[model samples]
Target: MNTNRPIRRALVSVYDKDGIEVLAEAFKRQGTEVVSTGSTARRLGELGVKVTEVEKVTGFPESLGGRVKTLDPHIHAGILADMTNPDQAKELKRLGIKPFDMVVVNLYPFADTVRSGAGESDVIEKIDIGGPSMIRAAAKNSASVAVITDPEDYQLAAQRVDSGEGFTLDERRCLAAKAFARTASYDATITEWTSKHWAKPGTINVPPVNADESNDATNAAKTTAPADNPQFPPTFTRTWERAHTLRYGENPHQQACLYADGLDRDGFAHAEQLNGKPMSYNNYVDADAAWRAVWDFAPQIAVAVCKHNNPCGLAIGETVAEAHLKAHACDPMSAYGGVIAANSTVTLEMAQNVRPIFTEVIVAPDYEPEALELLKTKKKNLRILRVANRPHTRTQFRQIDGGVLVQSIDRIDAEGDDSANWQLVSGDPADRATLKDLAFAWRAIRCVKSNAILLAHDQATVGIGMGQVNRVDSCHLAVERANTLADGENRAKGSVAASDAFFPFADGAEALIDAGVKAIVQPGGSIRDQEVIDAAQTHGTTMYLTHTRHFFH
Candidate 1:
């Protein structure tokens, strides 16, 4: 296994012919027999590179619309023959099959076809079948066969063959592993496409969302499908392509990497870095949290400052600059080095307002010229991201000890209209001015962590309490922070409160009322809802029941 094996017989078939001519020439110079199929063989012949056709190797012309060329046992036996086994060598010799010492192949562009919005028949025709089979057979016999799928590896293979030193077993095995991964990803893509577009009316082919699923090594790396349909289908296959590697995970000692669903836009997966150092693993997480929060309240000039995947402060203002200032002021200490994101473009004034803050990352739809210039000059190492727009993605996933917990993304409708979906439950109906503030608070609270309470005034978040054990504590924490920020001005006196879920007890409502919170909005589903409403009525605090709980745990 340690010895180098010379490449004698090579098969080269590819849909991407970018750098294959040089590779084929290198193989020819090494005296290797270059075999190919259909267009590839014709293209190589036109390039003055000699190549043996599949029909010549298999003794049968390609049929079934050129799909049955390489399915013969002769070609597969040649690719799969083991050089180290005497029996396999004797069998290949008896069958008159010339063993393939190398295989260079790239599959058809099924993914690209799907992306091109091609017809179903066109997309299906683009699925490469024999190509994957040849790659797999050669890869499995890596001890004797050198499998190469990526063109980037052509130079290294050529150098080895031309050096007269031959290909190393380790190189073969490495390429074999990559070949397997490539085929697996390809098949997974086809499976996903077919399941989505060509499945029977009653059948689905997705993995079931189960909390008690095993942490099997085979399922270590998972893919997230659309949460709109989370049922386990008849056929389930999952694969992901790595986006990038980060220096470390949440902690410095842990390892981490990023992956995407292959969509080119719509989320942070394809975010463009205008300026700054490379993003950390945690930076991606925090940036996603902030960006999603901003879009959750879209069309409003909103800003959300996030730390550790939870919104510390979020607000809506007349301008993005004012929004950033208000959101940052909610918890300046926590926002010191947090991630800041906005739903709209960041203007020059907004950049100036954020200049003093020691922010780690800033993300927005776009940046004005002055804003980009000022931020880039002020903080040479700050990570800035422009996502351009927010695309609707349905699925959300969280990895646990052994499995992934999959669910639908929280989408709040009727966020702007309080009277439409909310009921006046206690005290008095909110006035137009109070209702406007309550709407702002409701949208902001949706992004906070579980047991969340947000105190908002003047259409901006003043204080937020999140990740608490109980609702009462969160209420108290929000009011206390608001009072502290006021520093004697009594900011909470005319402020409104938004709760992520129903308060189980009346004490939570009482806590906000005692702090001079004039109005409150929350999902009402608790058995003690009447008691809570009575508490609000006793304190003369206006309360509305949204009947929609946004619990982000």
Candidate 2:
């Protein structure tokens, strides 16, 4: 088998014409025969490169509104023929079809068309049929043909052509692998879009069971209604393109890289980094946590300080600067070297306060010019990111031992913030200010890890304890931090506390009450609910039950 083959004949067809002129010039310089379809041929001709239209080789005009241009037998036979085989070479000669040494093709912009909100018919027309066929055929015959699917590879291909070396066996194989991945990702995108927009939910057709062997089990299985069709499709395919290779992973010993969903969406994954070194794995993790935490209070000036994928401080205020100050004051020691995120734009005032702190990353929707200038000058090593403020309602994925666990995002619903929905189970009714603080604490608590406790006053966290083995320990830790970290007076005094889950006993509530907490909010579903309520009433502490637990384990 020949390890190196010269590119004497080539087939090129692409929707994206970027860098096509350079490749055409290289083909002209190397005296390589080129055949392209329709607009591609026109483009190459306009670039002063001689080209043969695909129809001239196939002896068939493009039909079906150009959909049937490259689907002919001549085009594919040339791509798939094994020239090393004498029988195949003789057959190709008899058919008057020349074999292709190189195939350059890129598929239609189906994903982009779908994302543009085009009509069904318009999107369907954008789905290319002949392109993938040619790509796969050439890729399968990589020993003889080099397939190019991305325009980014045009420069490399042009250089190889200019060098007169064509492509080596290893180079062809690598290109083949990339070609297959491109097709797979394209098909997965089409499948996902069709399942969500076109497919209808219906009962699965089950095979008939023998009457003699039929039982209740078989009958039940035959009629079981499946989950929603779009959400849980018959086949699930996820594809992400590599975005960056980080310096290291969570630690220096672990290797890691970042992948993007290949969509024009808003989130930390697609955020633009304006300053600082490349983000590390842990930096992305903590920055994402903080970004999500602050967005929970959207349309308001909210700030979150996160460390190790857990929020140490979160607060909402009238301005971004005030919010940052209050959130930072929650636990300055914990906020040191933490990631910060703001729901609103970062202002000059906010940057001034952040300049003194040692923050690993700061992400927000936007940044004022003065603020950005200050941060870029004062903190050259800090990762400053700008992400668009958009609703993030996508599903979440977590890898397990052998598979992945998928669930919808645990978004704070409207009921979670409406004080009227909360049940006043113990003590006097909370006033307006106390109810506001309770709502803020409840929303902020979801950002903490399981067995979490958060104390808030004036819509800013004063204390937070998370990742404890028991609720009692978390309660004690929160109170301790509140009082010990107070700037002047006890921060826990007249503060509202939020628990992620129900307390098994009354000791947790007793600890908070003893720390001067005036109100407590939790999902009341414990077996000893009366005991817990009695403890709160005995201490004259206002308590509200949300009936919804936000366990974040």
Screening candidate 1 with a backbone cut-off below 3 angstroms (N, C-alpha, C), the clashing residue pairs are: 204-233
Per-residue lDDT for 1-553 in model 2, tens only? 5488888899999999988988999988988899999999999999987899999999999998988999988999999998768998899889998999999999899877875778999999988899999999999999889999989999998988888778999999999999999999988878767766776645655345567766887666444524443554445786777889988898899999998765445656888999999999999999998988988887788999999999888999899999999999888998999999998999999999999999999999899999999999999999999997554646788899988877668888847556678999898999999988998999999889989999999999999989999999999999988888866569888899999999999999999999999999999999999999999989888999999888888
Q: Positional deviation of 208 in candidate 1, in angstroms?
A: 18
Name the TM-score of candidate 1. 0.87
lDDT of 2 at 37: 95
Quote the lDDT for 29 in model 1: 81
Cα misplacement distance, residue 471 of candidate 1 (Å): 1.9
lDDT per prediction? 0.84, 0.89
Candidate 1 displacement at residue 48 in angstroms: 5.9
